[model samples]
Target chain A: MLSVVILGTGNVAFHLAKVLSSNNSVELLQVYGRNKTKLQAFEPFCDTTDNLGKLAAAAIYLVAVSDGAITALTQQLAGLDGVVAHTSGAVSLEVIDHPRPGVFYPLQTFTRDKKIPFAEVPICLEARHPNDLRLLAQLAGKLSGAVHRIDSAQRRQLHLAAIWVNNFTNHLLYIGQQLCEEKGLSFSLLQPLIQETVDKIQQLSPKEAQTGPARRRDVQTIQTHLDILEAPLQKKIYQLLSESIKSTYEKEL
Target chain B: MLSVVILGTGNVAFHLAKVLSSNNSVELLQVYGRNKTKLQAFEPFCDTTDNLGKLAAAAIYLVAVSDGAITALTQQLAGLDGVVAHTSGAVSLEVIDHPRPGVFYPLQTFTRDKKIPFAEVPICLEARHPNDLRLLAQLAGKLSGAVHRIDSAQRRQLHLAAIWVNNFTNHLLYIGQQLCEEKGLSFSLLQPLIQETVDKIQQLSPKEAQTGPARRRDVQTIQTHLDILEAPLQKKIYQLLSESIKSTYEKEL
Candidate 1:
């Protein structure tokens, strides 16, 4: 059985602790957090403590803290003889101040209230030694269906892509919701269309799946849409994205 | 039964024809398309015509052509007793020259090969008279679970919002896919995260759902991400969106 100890009490930490504690082939030895109240949520599932010096012996020490806290937290585990790893997409594995530092980044968003099924999440692993990489992969395999040994550079690129797909895309949806609210239309009306847009990508590449006035270069409709948008930021965004879409298609043609 | 004659053989027309013909309360009288080869796809299921002059008489003439073609198609049915309607989100109702003009816009993207169940699609209806609106709504209700009475102004606004959510969101996915390809990572690795992003918005408002380096105002990670992106356009987009997200949360604070 793979023994693991998780640090931090954030969304990622909470989720990792729950999944590690529940897995049949894994033993979650302890969970460490700075805030006592936040650590309480992990207490019922496993041994919990606010003191990093009191960390138990485990095969792996998984740091699931914020990017800023990761380095300092890893520093506190200087004496631990385990494969030290941080669960971050953007942060590099070099942040871990240990001889056997590694990464166990799960490329999925975690919310405190939402219980995500660990099986479908892709676990990206990295390590300095072959044995440590294999050990990390083995533990990740137990909790997830997919795992990859990605370097710090590739992981950083993946994190950037994640922001584009998740952060930027959600922002567009927010803009759409605002427009709906101002025009007295239910935002729910656009849900099916949004779903279909994602669905199309499953069958066709996003380039092939693209459709709209922008893709067709409908100048009249584009002008009309620009006229309708009252917000300067919204108009600028609309114009820029529309131009981008048009250029993407224009290159293909 | 409400008799309907569908014009055009595009994605919208193809899907609408299939759904209307299947509904017991609606009789899909005929389908018209300028191209004979495209019309053949609809021939096996219902009557297909290349000549608009041979258009059958029905209670509603649904013009499901491109936005530019809507006016001309509606003019072809000028003297028909049916309630003439164009299925367009951006085009105003005044484009339909008929005295009894209406709209039967289904607010979902349609692809020819992908068979979308009409029951989940939201149909937006508008008309010159209340009776025509009711007639269009009744037919729309048979095929869809949700129907809304939206005027030309509201429909235009909804169309603009659709561009933001559907078109712009898809483009972001395209950008993400490109980055994944460049880094030798499978784009599928990001799918679960993308799904979670949308799922979160379903429960929380998009504003509340927003989370990322930008939303947290993590300038260090933001700059790191921007540095990782080599493309000038990609960098510009990242900066603009990150600023937008930062400003959005700053306002809330």
Candidate 2:
């Protein structure tokens, strides 16, 4: 059985603890957090501690902290025999400052209120030593069905992609909501269209799935749309994205 | 029973025919298309006619043609006593020269290959006369669970929102795919993250659902991401979107 101790009380840490504790093949030893109230959620599941020095000995120390705090937090876990790993997509594994530095990044967006299914999330692992990598892979397999061996550089790229697909996409939806509200229309009316857009990409590549006035190069409609947008930022975004789509298809056509 | 004749053989026309034909209260009298080969798909379900003069008499003549073709197509059905309606989100009802001009737009993306459930798709109806509006709403209700009486101005706004939610979001996914291909990573790894992002919005407002380095105003990570992106367009989009997100939360905070 692989013993794991998760450090931090953020969304990533909370989710990792839940998945690890549920797996029969893994033993979740303790959860360490600086905030007492935040650590209360993990108290019922396992041993909880605010003091870093009282961290339990485990096969692996999973540091699920913020990007700014990761390096400083890892420095505090010095002289530990267990492999030290951070669950960050952007931060490099080299920031661990340990002989057995590694990464156990789960490529997913986690919300505190929403419970994500562990088996579906892709877990990306990296380590310098073969034994450390094998152990991380084994633990990742228990938590998720999809496990990939990705280096720090590749992980950083994947994280950048995540921002586009998740962060930017959400912001676009926010803009859509604002547009709807301005015209006294219900945002719910566009839900089916939004869902179908995502569903199409599952079967066809995004390039093939693209469709709009911009893709068709309908100049009149594009001009009309630009004229309708009230916000300067929205107008700029619409122009840039439309130009990008037109250029992308122009090469193929 | 309401007899309806459909015009054109594009994705919108084909999907609308399927749903209307399935409803017991509606009779799909005939399908008119200029292309003989494309009209074959509807031959088994209804009478197919390439000649506009051969159009069968019906209570409603639904013109499901391209935006540019709608005006000319509606003019062709000039003498028909039926209520003439076009299924376009962008086009105004004023384009239909018929005395009983109307619109029966389904607010969802229709692909030729994919069959969408009619019950889940919202149907937006508009007409000049109350009787025509009632008849259109009745037909729309038979095909969909959600029906709304939207005027031309409001429908145009909804169409603009559709572009942001569907077209622009798809472009963002395309950008994400490009980044993944550059780093030799599978795009499938980001699918779960994409799914979660949409699912969260169902429960929370899109404004509340936003999360990332930009939302937190983490300049260090945002700059690192910008430095990593090679394409000028990609970098510009990243910076612009990040700035938008930062500005949005700055007001809220």
Candidate 3:
């Protein structure tokens, strides 16, 4: 069995600990966090501690902490012989000061309130040593079906790509909800449309899947939409995104 | 059985015809389109006609043409005694010049290539006459579980909201895919993240569900992302959206 120890009792850490503890092929040794209150949530699954010195020697150490604290946390684990992987998409494997520096980036958003099935989440793995990479891969393989061996540069790009897809997309939906609230319309009315937009890209490329006034360059409709938007930010966003969409399909238009 | 005549042979008209043809309660009488080529697709399901003069009398006439063509087509159907409803979200109920003008907008993006199940689609119905509205509600109820009685003003706002959720969201995904392509990373890597973002909003409001650097106000990560984006438009979008997100949570930050 591949033994794993998860550091940092955040959303990623809690989830990793939960999944690892339940897996028959793996042993979850311990979970560490600076906050004692957060560590309590992991108590039922495995050994939890706020003290870093109490960390056990496991085959893989998954540092599921904030991006800013990743380097500092990994520096503290420099003496560990096992593969030290930080569960961050943006932060590099180089940040880990351990002899066996690695990355165990799960390319999915995690929420403490919501339970996510890790099997479908693509876990991007990277390590300086081939054996360490394989060790991390085996641990990831136990937790998820989708495991990708990605370099630091590729992972960083994926993180940036994620910001556009998840972060920016969610913000747009927030804007939609705000617009609905302003007009006293139910935001739920637009839910199916949002679902369908995501569904369309599964079969077709985003460019091929794109439609609407901006793509068609229907100037009048765009103007009508712009006129109704009360907020300056909303109007600017509408104008900018419309222009971007138009420019994207400029040749076709 | 409620008899219905469909006008226009676009994506909306095609889907409506497909659903109505199979529905036992809906007698889909005839479909009319200016282009005979486009009308041919509806021939297997119902009587297809290129000439508006050849239109048959029915309980309801659904004008499913482009927003620009909606007014002119509805004007031509002025002599029809049936309730004439244009299947458009943005267009007003007044655009239908028939004696009983109505709106039967299915609030979902329709693509001819992908077959969407109508049962879950939100059909927003509006009419000047209460009886006509009830007739639409009945028809909408037959096709979809989610039928909403909405006024023209509210439906217009919903349409605007849809542009943000569906159109703008799709554009963001397109940008994400573009970023991945530029970096030689697999676009599919980000698919799971995108799905989770949509799924999160179903349970929580978009504001409550929001995450990433912008929401956390991580200026360092935001700057790093901005530095890597080489395209001018991409950089502008990142900056604008990051600024928008920061401004949104400015009070919290």
Candidate 4:
């Protein structure tokens, strides 16, 4: 069994600690965070440390601190005798500055309350040393069925694309919720549609699966939708996205 | 059993015809479309018709025609002896006129090859008369577990929102796929993140459920992501969406 230390108590750190603790191949070593209360949440399964010097005890230290805290945390761990890594998709490896550094960024969304099934989650791994990379890959494989070694450049692209698919798409749902309330329509009606939109992508290409006024190139329908959406910003977004979809289908708009 | 005349051969019409034809309560009277080849796909379970006048024999005429064709199809069905409606979420009910007009908006993403369980799909019903509304609602209920009396205003909003959540989001995935190809990574690696994103909405509100660089106000991560985006348009979208997400959490951005 391999031992690991997690440094941070945010959503990702909490979930990662919970997952790593439950696995038989992994031993929970210690948790490091500044907030004593937050640090106490993980004391049930492992020892606690608020100092960076204590993190040197573990073979693998996960720097699960915030992006701002990551620089200072890694700076403090610059002399640590272990494989230090950050759980960030966009942050570069140089941010670690630690002698033995890598990335163990999980490419799945994590909420404090939502328990994600690791069987379906994808873990993105990157490390300079072949041995350390193999260790991260093996450890990730234990937690999830799928694991990939993606470099900083690829992970950056993935993170941006996630913005489009997850964050942007979700904001759109929020807009729909607001629109539904105004029209006295229940937001529940659109839930199934949202789920299916995502499900269709599993089998069909997005370009081929797209269906709507813009996909149909129905100017009348587009005009009507714009008329209904009186908000200037909403109308702009609708137009930009509609044109984008049309261009994707090789249609002259 | 109620008789129905399905008037189109596209994805929506195809799926609707298939679901209705499979049920014991629906007596599929005829399947009509301008193209014989498209109508041929549904020939086994329906009596295919190309002429508009031939469609007057059924109790309900479902005009699953394109948004642009809805008006023309309704004009053709003016003298028909049955209730006429279209499956467009954004099209107004007035396209088919008052006394016999209706809207049968199946609020779900439909793919020609992927068979969706219509029982879980939401059906939005709207009609002129109380009797017609009830008839449509009952018919919709037979095929789906949930049915709602959604008007043109509300349905249009739902359609607009789907554009943001589905079309735009999928485009984002396409961008990610492009990014993966450039960096020698498989887009399939993103499937877990995509699935978890949709799953998250089940429990938390999209606003309350958002994660990533923007929510955390991690400008370094955002700047790194923006620098790595190969396409200029992609970067602009990334900037705008990140700004939007940031505005949601922090007003100072």
Q: TM-scores of the models, in the given order?
A: 0.95, 0.95, 0.96, 0.94
- Range of the 10 consecutive residues with the lowest summed lDDT in candidate 4 chain A: A244-253
User: Per-residue lDDT tens digits of candidate 2, residues A1-253?
Assistant: 8999999998899988887887889999999999999999998778999998888889999999888888888888886789999999998888887788899999888877778888989999999899999999989988889999999999999999999999999999999999899999999998988888889888888988887889888888889899999888778888889988998999766
Q: Between candidates 1 and 2, which one is better according to lDDT?
A: 2
User: For model 4, how does the per-residue alpha-carbon lDDT over B1-253 read when each residue is reduced to its tens digit?
Assistant: 7789998899999999888889998888889999988889999777898887676487788888877677777777767666787898877898775259988998877879988889988888888888888878878988998888888877877777666666666666666666767777777877877787778878988877788777888788788777777666667667777766676677644
Chain A TM-score by candidate, in order: 0.96, 0.96, 0.96, 0.93
Q: A1-92, model 1: which lDDT tens digit per residue?
A: 79999998988999999888888899999999889999999987799989877999999999988899888778878888989999999988
Order the numbered candidates by DockQ, best leading: 3, 2, 1, 4
* Clashing residue pair totals per candidate (backbone < 3 A): 0, 0, 0, 0
| Candidate number that wins on DockQ, 1 or 4 | 1
Tell me which residue pairs clash in candidate 1.
Answer: none
True contacts kept of 4: 0.61
* Candidate 4 iRMSD, 1 decimal: 1.8
Model 4 C-alpha RMSD to native:
2.2
Cα deviation in Å at residue B232, candidate 3? 1.3
Which tens-of-lDDT digit does each residue in A74-160 have in candidate 3? 888877778888989887888877788899999998777777878889999999999998898888888788999998888889999
lDDT for position B27 in model 4 = 89
List residue ranges in candidate 3 displaced over 4 A: none
lDDT of 3 by residue, B1-253 (tens): 8999999888889999999999998999999988988888999999888888889999999998888888877888878788999999887888776789989999998888888888999998988889999998989999999999888888888999999999999999998998888878889888888899999987888888778899888888898898999988788888888989988899986
**Highest-scoring model, DockQ:** 3
